[model samples]
Target: MRTGVPLRQESLVTPLRLPSLIGCALSLALAAGAAFAQTGTPALPPADEREPIRLLVGLPPGSGVDRISRVFAEALSQRLFRPVNVENRTGARGNVAGEELARSTPDGNTLGVVTATTMILNRHLSRQMGYDPQADLTPISRFASLPLLVLGGPGQGVRTIGELIEVLKARPSTCGTPGAGTAQHLALELLIRSVGARCDFVHFRGIAGALPELLDGGVQVYVEAAVIGLPLVREGRVRLLAVTSRVRSALLPETPTVAETVAGYEAETWLALMGPRGLADSVLVKLEAAAIAVARDAAVVRRLRALSAEPIGGTRTELAATIRAQDSIWGPVARAAGVTAD
Candidate 1:
């Protein structure tokens, strides 16, 4: 009787355990499927079958755009199992590179890392822009957004936005920008207009040329990408008065935002992946997938954060919407400010 009872119990438990094992396996398979759906599979050709990928950058090497482009290029090379190279095509406030990208073969081999200035502002500021951002380029994804830092040089005696305003009211001040129609210049113009302060803008060919002027008081204030200005601020060479973002930066929580001081003032630059118009849908899918993957990566997020940039990943539709929205906001502002590149 005891042996019969034990066999009956074993039979019942075995039946339940088999079902439990099967359920666990199914759950794991479903989880994997969900993950794959979110990230999407790599759609580009295998390394052996594909040509080397070129990432075209509009800014000089060591600029914020160039740095971010190289980071993404490295991450993409690993993820796509292909050799990725960064080509600096610096000129025309990023228009030279934009034209090159617009003329490239749309076979997934050429991609451009562009900013708001490259895609939206340049066209509004210059009539002779060689390529139409909306028509000549296909946005793959917007990968990051960088806030601008309003920095005061040594001997400026102004450590806060309020003090800067006071100084401007008392005497005219000059702000250094990287270029005439660049985002930095636009941001400075917006700030001046918002506060009704008196300031002149000095355009430099690049930030490297602008920094020395900033340090020596050739320029009283400089508005530049945080990635480029934060290091100098940290070294005690410059004072960070405010960031141009609507909110304070995570990397500089103690620093205030321009909007906090001057109502309705907010400006930030963004980076996007784009290809020449007429790119194959297949190529776009693969490039977008890789961009989204890199933008979502933990290491990439950490690196961008270190540079005071916010990582943003989204679809082509979303990127296009961003471009359109920025154009709508900045176009009128540029025209109002008489900001023409040529």
Candidate 2:
């Protein structure tokens, strides 16, 4: 989202400062980088000695996740004393990039910034996936948590979740999802199942492509990231029926959570950093420290807040546990709904 400097070689060493506390912590990251580099083979270059760290996103260039990841990547590179390069390896509902990351060397040089689909939903939806998310990846940290918004075009008669339910019950309505195995798709499926509402689902390559249908009334509803839906809602081009987060979104506090209507109904999309499985413990520790530092930076917090995202930084163990819990909770629901890879 920012285009300033071309990410100079010195900027990596130049501190990416936050307001106050963040600056102090990132100084520690610089110290750690120095210490970590020295403790290892001096012949082995500084973390900056390697080419830019490749941060892969499984989605295409213009996707919300891609845009957000690029912002963080740019910021983190400036903070972590290394160039951060973001690449889009798009295909297979993000399975292609997941597979590539899972297969990449575990040197902490190649990391993946992917959504919940690469780690959780894909596992539930397909058994023939090429890589094992848990077995083949090392969780670095999570930087953002995004809620899903239910959107409708004008004349849909769906001013509220209640009205949306009424409209769907009166006639079979169609909802569009970004991809077949995405949190957007599954969240809609969960809602339909919980409310016992019969509706059809339309799968688009991604949210940008799907929004057109909602704008034109080609689809009655869309479940997508708030970052994408907020602008439309603000423009009066679309109506936000509800947010799937249990709590009201900071971006649209006026909109109630779907959980308010259907208790126990909540879902969200998350973006996290992960590396190839078997990443060295030392390298993993350094990478995790860098990620934690980035997420806690005041500037990072401000940027994510603008997008209605909450920053979360934790140990790899915590991320793994989260993935496990999510998998357990959604597996049966996905199966019962007959969700599968497209």
What is the Å distance of residue 210 in model 1 from its true position?
5.8
Off by over 4 Å in 1: 1-49, 169-171, 204-219
User: What tens digits encode model 2's per-residue C-alpha lDDT throughout 78-97?
Assistant: 66667899999998878899
TM agreement with the true structure for every prediction:
0.78, 0.78
- Considering only N, C-alpha and C atoms within 3 Å, which residue pairs clash in candidate 2? none
Residue range with the least summed lDDT across 10 consecutive positions in model 2? 41-50
141-187: candidate 1 lDDT, tens digit per residue: 99989989988877767889888878776778888888777788888
Q: What is each predicted model's overall lDDT from 0 to 1?
A: 0.85, 0.82
